[model samples]
Structures are given as structure tokens and as C-alpha cells.
Target chain A: DAMVIQNPRYQVTQFGKPVTLSCSQTLNHNVMYWYQQKSSQAPKLLFHYYDKDFNNEADTPDNFQSRRPNTSFCFLDIRSPGLGDAAMYLCATSRDLGLETQYFGPGTRLLVL
Target chain B: GESVGLHLPTLSVQEGDNSIINCAYSNSASDYFIWYKQESGKGPQFIIDIRSNMDKRQGQRVTVLLNKTVKHLSLQIAATQPGDSAVYFCAENEDTGFQKLVFGTGTRLLVSP
Candidate 1:
């Protein structure tokens, strides 16, 4: 029943260390998304990948990068973690795009020390 | 810049009563509006959605109402139960080919028994 899965429910990293979060989907979705959500705030889109094409948000920092190795696997890499990067990292997937309902994973809580 | 926001940050309702969460959006060109329920320590789950051409849509015990004239959206939960307590968010699909989702500030729903 677990369609979308994110490994390491909680992750801890040093301020300047690089960290990567992994996501996998059993739904065979073509589009995957990454979002960062701080306490009591809205989830902001960091970037998304449609197949092999990656799309980054205008406000997304260069420190954040994403990779989709295949159809079911995607990774979010924070090159240099900062205090402000401590938040929930959510991974979502959609069948195609447009009006499709996006399925979300349980999320990974990242803590930057 | 398009933004989505909630009218209230928190809402408390009796278990047997109905709960209504409101959201406002600045983008009128959004193709689809979706409602998501997110519990603590979990990612968002899709509840219901309404397209720009539709005014209302229903799913199980949840109903999504979209008022394009006012650029407003609302989610109504019938016969609220304690399990329904969570944060509800309204997201607008920007339809920018990537189908970017602009999420609203979440409204915390507390169903008290």
C-alpha cells in the first residue's frame, strides 16, 4: 500500500556537510517533486523532474540539487546544509502532470547542526 | 507572483460538527485546485480537487468548493471526527507546463471530542 517511500525519516547533517535524501515510488510516476517546509509554513517547491528533464524553481537556491536516476528513484541533494535548511523534505510524484493528483511520501525531517 | 493563503491559521470543531477551511489564491489562471490533509509527522494526502471549470467537487466525506469569481477555495469535512484533525492545505496548479503547485498557508483543524 505504500506507493511513495522516502528513506531515513530523520536526517542529521553538519552545517557545511552535503546530505542526500532518497525517494522511490511504486506507482511508476513520470514526474517527481521536492519541497521544503519549515515550521508552520507552506511547503515551497525546490525542484521537480519530469522523466529526465529537471525543472528548478526560480527561488530555489543553487545549493539544492536533484537527480532522478530512473523512473522510480529520485534524490534530493543539499550540497551544503545550513541552519535554515532544517525542515521537512517532502517528495511527491504524479502520473503525468497537469491535473493529475500528486502522491506524497512520508517525508524526511532534516536537521542541520 | 502568484500566492495562495488561508483565511485562518487554526480551526477547532466538535467531533460531530462540520468543519470548514478556507483558502484564497491570487492566480486566476490556475488549472486545478487541490486540497490536501497533512497530519503531524506525515506528508500531505490528497483529499479532493476542483478544476477551474467546476465550482464544486465531492469525495467521500470531503467536499471541495471553488469560487473562481472571488478566487477562493474551501474544504468542508462532514461529521468531523478526532481522526480528522490535521493541517489542511489548498494548492493551485499553475499549469506552466511543469504543473507547478502553489500551496497555500495551511489551516490546522482540531477536531475535539
Candidate 2:
């Protein structure tokens, strides 16, 4: 089945170290999104790519960045991991059709020591 | 501009019972709405959706109701099962430019057997 896939379902990184999470999709969607979800809170939008165009949320920290290398793969990078950055990272994709629904990958849970 | 939100933080229901989750949005311009279910250690999965033109839409065992006038949305689950226990969220999006979806703080649904 065509679906979204994430690598390294669980990630551990030392404080101030860099970590990268990857997402791949077989659905051939036009938009890919990255979200950070902490315990008991909403999944906050970090950034998204409309093809190669990147759109970052106003409140997203500079420590977080994303890249869509091509149509099927996207990567989320944390330049310097902090303890507060430990959370679930979600990746999603949707078609360009105006009313299309998004498909999400199993998230990568990051832990910063 | 869509400010999607949910009314409750948590809900408890018995297996085989019906469950209702409610949400409210601030943007009337949002033309598309979706409900998602997220299990522990997993990503949010699309459950159902309703358009602004329609008040209700049904899926296999889920239904979404949209009340544009009151800016309210609700999801109904029939014959709820243990596997249905998860955090549920509602998201809204506009039909025009920048198809960014705004999601609400989720409601944790506990289905007890």
C-alpha cells in the first residue's frame, strides 16, 4: 500500500548534538509537513514543503530545519538537540488538490540527553 | 485563516458504545475539515472529513459533522472498540492559497472493555 514511512522510529542524541529524521512517501503527494508533538499538547507545525518551496511556521525555532530533497523524501534536522526537544516528530504528505487529506507516517520519537 | 480547536481534553467510553468528540473553529473561510486518530507511538491517521457545503459525512464506522454557522465540528464513532482508544484531533484548512492545515489540541479517547 502507498504510505508514508519514517526512519529510525526511536532516536537518541546527546545534548547540543545534531540529529536528522527522514520521511519517505510512495503516495506521490505534492506537499510534505513536519510537526513536533510534546506530551499532552498539540502537534505544532514546524515547517512544510510545497514541492521545493519551504514554508516555516513563524514560531518555529531556528534549531529546527527541513529539506525536501525530491518528490518522495523529506528530512527534518535539529541542529542542536536539547532536553526540551525530546518529543515525537511527525511527517505527513498531501496531494495538491485543494480538499485533499493528509497521510502521516509513524512518528520518530527523539530523546535528547 | 483557520483557528481550529477542540472542546474537550479527554473522553471515556465503554467498548461497543458510541463516542462523540467535539471541536470549534474560528475561521469561517475554512472549507475543508478532517478528523484524525493517533495511537501511542504512532502518527495521526485520517478518520473522516466534511466539507463546508455538507453538514455531515460518514466513513466505515466514523462520522463527521460540521456546523458552519456555529463553527462547530464533531466526530462520532459507532460500536467503539478497544483499538479505537486514541487521541483524536480535528483540523481545518482553506480552499485557496497555502493549504496549511491548522490542527486542534486533541481529545484523548479511552475505550474500556
Error of 2 at A38 (Å): 0.7
Off by over 4 Å in 2: B1-8, B94-96
Predicted candidate 1 versus true structure: per-residue lDDT over A9-95, tens digit per residue: 999999999999999999998999999987777788889999999999998999999999999999999999999999999999999
Q: What TM-score does the predicted chain A of each candidate obtain versus native chain A?
A: 0.97, 0.96
User: Residue B62 CA error for candidate 2 (Å)?
Assistant: 1.3
Best by TM-score: 1
Best by lDDT: 1
Error of 2 at A72 (Å): 1.0
RMSD of 1: 2.0
Residue A18 alpha-carbon offset, candidate 1, angstroms: 1.0
The CAPRI category of model 2 is medium
Worst 10-residue lDDT window, candidate 1 chain A: A37-46
TM-score of chain B of 2: 0.90
Pick out the ten consecutive residues of candidate 2 chain B with the lowest summed lDDT. Answer: B1-10
